[model samples]
Target: MKKLFIAAILFVSSSCIKVIDPESNYITGDQLASSADALAGMVRAIPVRLVNYQNDDAGIEQCSYHGMLSMLEMMTTDMVVSGYGGFNTTSAYTYGNLSARGSNRGIYPFYMYYGYIKAVNDVIGLIDSETDDTTLKHYLGIAKAYRALFYMQVGAIYEYKAPTDSRYTEYYVAPEHDLTELTVPIVTETTTGLDVKNNPRATFDTLYEFILSDLKNAETLLADYTPSSKVYPSLAVVYGLYARAYMEMASHKNATENYMQALNYAQLAITTSGCSFLTEDQWLDPKTGFNDMTSQNSWMLACSISEGNTDGQGGGFHHTMLFGTETTYSSYGWRVGRSLNRKTYEAISDNDFRKLSWLGPDFFATETHYDDEAGKWAYTLRSADDTYVGNYRLTSDPQWLRNRITVANGFLAMPWIYPGIKFRCYAGNYTSRYPGCATDLPIMRVEEMHFIKAEAQYHLKQEEEARSTLKEIMNHRITDSSYTCIASGENLLDEIMLQKRVEFWGEGINFFDAKRLGLGVDRGWQGIGYSRYQGTYDIDGIAFFWTIPFPTAEEDGNPALQGYNNPYMYNTAMFTYQSNAALSQYYGIPPSYGN
Candidate 1:
């Protein structure tokens, strides 16, 4: 699949920037400058091209930008994917095959992002920058903002710093193999094929400078523009992108000034967006939970997935994350679906409303504690050999677990102990079995701005302000009225990050967070929570596996990437198994469930 995609990419042109279709006659620059509708259509296609474009030949449901990147990002962290589902294809990430450049998962993002970048560049190239047309300026701003967003993702994933660099030594252990700092090559409107052939990865300073410039341009052009849908980039979304870029920049350079910029932009986004946090009822809504972006004021940017338009076939975000839907892959008993790390799960206070997002290990024992009158439990025990054994029905406030039975006669009925129910399938009819994969996925929510603000406040030494910000989010998430964030210093930062982790679980933001914070993957220690393949190993200091290698196709085609690619760490034994205990005991599961 990767080779096929790469072949197609190469067939179009030798350069990544020329991924646009060569066979079709493209509209000339003069035509685009004169035609408002054509230009508007191109601007509209930017988000859809990146987020909603379907590539079935990839043979993975995660072919879309959000789906592919989210899967890859989550797999790199403590998030667990069940071996029983189609997501098992991404297990390479869990097993520390991050350098599998030929693999579909490894190259998909590189292909997708660069392809999307080319499309955005075409729109930008056709438009005259000096034009007085407000609408053209708005269109240009949207294109630039998306370009910045895509570049930020690329830089976050592929950027590397050498051990000799003082900044690298401060945050990470020196890898056994020598490496040099590198970001993806910058391609823009005027970047020709000859220029791309000689394009070397940009330095961190160079890459981020370009990103900030694009965002600044976006900010000015979008000053008077308002988008009707959350799908388009609004002024607030641009501010959020500024926050995102600066945060990533701070992580790489360890600059206090960058942190200040991130802090400022985050606060700007919060005040300007006018988007409120998700109410407790909205957060846990069984029918519309995390699916309907239109009804939720909290979502700042989202992509709507309607029926017949999804990257489905059991591979989309809804199919992989939401287990309660009967039509999805996670509903089957044999599939483990998406589960939480037990350590992280245990960290949440029992009273925290978010704790209800996952099924407790002892859910079977605690079934009676929940109110049945509210239709919380989606399934019930009928008989030992009942046909409805795996059938699940939607209810008003259904909890994580589908059924009540732990053991059905001689069979151990329950499969995943901590499968996530935070992201539920769209439920127009509460009783409908065929919910389909039509859940609208959130790209950015206002709640994230709150988190970004809190962390930046902590880094800026505004301890009291940081605590208040953390408390503000916690007060909403935790049902306890008296709860406060009292942790000071590094612990306070940890509390902020922990809450962020819990808040954005299965949302694909954690991998970047962990990388930026210089945290290691510690899933192999005793009492670890990861199940299956990821349970056996830990990476101390920094998990360089999180550093993705440039796809082999990119390296092969681009002369400048040859011998300068990110080091392949798979054979280095970078990840080691530190525990000798039985797998079941390591996972804290009972011995009856034989491993």
Candidate 2:
């Protein structure tokens, strides 16, 4: 597979450079359909290129999907940036003073996704003109599916144009403003270079209509195609994408029909894909937890790493977010950016298996057994007969706790008490050379379908049905089956959102969910002291949110888009933080928070 990918890149690079086509030089619409091998390589390169887009000549940071996700996850209230010693981009975004003319937070995704869109359009254009073969349409379908997915992502970040009738205010602009007007351009195979140069943002209704049309075509074309890898978009993936889009659309209306559409498509994805939710044991596996191929069975779509792919060495997701990789990669290491909010951590039920995804407050007594498969030492409490209970325990033995917790190399630092390990590097094996990890990133999972279905049912006012659906997923995840949800009214949605925050913790959908639902987040009283943003903000208000701006560079290049930037405002004072004596005892105060 590595050799094949290298050959594909060689083919793409070695060809004569085309001034007209910037993304690919070797392939034209006419030449693309000539050979099966060439066509396959071209299709294969789409995902390879998508995942490999790390940085550019500008001071842009990691722009890969995983990188973008890590950035977005850190912005949410569920996460706390424990330190600011790493990327300045993380620090800039955490401060939430992003300007339309300057911020890389909004700018990098545009660069990344537009590059991908152009590649997909090249393939789609070839197929549209030359091929009638069902096999060829499979590639076309895959391209369209990917295009829809990218458009959805761009729209979610920049501006989500709601249905014209929506009563929801356009987030962060003004009270009366709504998202009826779109801020993103709708690019397709038919869009020429000239069209791109003169592109104007379309209406929200127009963009979504085109997205749905593309998805509908993709679904029909890929109906008989079985994907070769979990990373590839298959029929099931198309259904899942459709369900996700509809769920976002449902937020615009008070009707049950859109919710029903979301529910139905989610059901199709679950049943057609034949995927199952991860068991508690599977989720807690130290060797291959949420970040590797062991969980691929539940993933409808994922990103696969191969030898030909770039390691994204200094700017990759794991390099910046996971501290355990510090032993291997010193230059790209960070130990404090991925801490969990203490309040959100406490909200989780003790019996829930997801709590194991992060480090707990309790310190263990001693260094214990090394599992051969894990290739890492884990502290475990044992019975009198030396029968092991589990991988974790609470210990008040100060001598033992102090010795183990305060190890050299900054291991288990106080502020990193809830170090998030959900998206860490795989144990025992390195996917690439040192500093470059090969852990696969899942894009969509089977458990998300259940959450979508439950949310849809809740919106439709099917309270009992929604409760049962939520319980179905909860029963599989927790050790105590007797635990029941008592949330009603708005609390029901709160419960659903909490489950999502837990399930997808580091996988990266929390901020987007908060954006779509117009939810406010409090970065906890304890957490406000740790965040560079100072405190939480209403996601739809003027203070802080994950909303991106159309960069000034883009505005300067495109004459049609001048003066089109969104409103910008900042809070006058930092949020007040009431000190907690117990928290102060657990973690000592730093010199300065925003430092």
Tens-place lDDT digits, model 1, residues 1-595: 0001112222111111224455463444674557777667666666655444433433223445556566555544457543243335555565656653544566566767777887688778877788788988988888898899889887777777432323233444444444555678999988887898889888888998899999999999999989977878889999999998888888767769988999999989989999998887887776677778887799988766555443332333333233443233343322444566666777788778887776654443322222357522222333333332111223432332234323331112233246566666667432333344466777889999999999989988999999998888888887676667789899999889889988987666787787777666655444444444443455444465667777777777788887777766554233334322343333344323332
| Candidate 2 positional error at 42, Å | 1.9
Which lDDT tens digits does candidate 2 get at residues 1-595?
0011122234231121123333444434455467677677767767765555633443464445666666666667676655433433454455555566554455676777776786677677667534679878899899999999888878777773322212224423541334344548777767655776777666656777878988999998999999878768989889999998888777766457778999999999999999998887567664556556555478888875553433433344443234332223432334334566656676788888788666654432224443658643344432224322244422122233334333242332242346555554545233333323555678889899999998888888887888889999898877579759877777898898888888987676777787777655555343233533343332422124455666777767776565554445434233333333332332322222321
TM-score of each: 0.82, 0.81
Candidate 1 Cα outliers beyond 4 Å, as residue runs:
1-26, 53-62, 82-87, 161-179, 308-334, 365-416, 428-435, 571-581, 589-595
Candidate 1 overall Cα lDDT vs. reference?
0.64
Q: How many residue pairs of model 2 clash at the backbone?
A: 0
Off by over 4 Å in 2: 1-27, 54-58, 84-89, 160-181, 294-296, 307-314, 317-327, 330-333, 364-416, 430-436, 524-543, 570-595
Clashes of each: 0, 0
Go through the candidates in order and give the C-alpha RMSD of each one to the true structure: 7.4, 8.2
Which candidate should be chosen as best, given TM-score against the real structure? 1
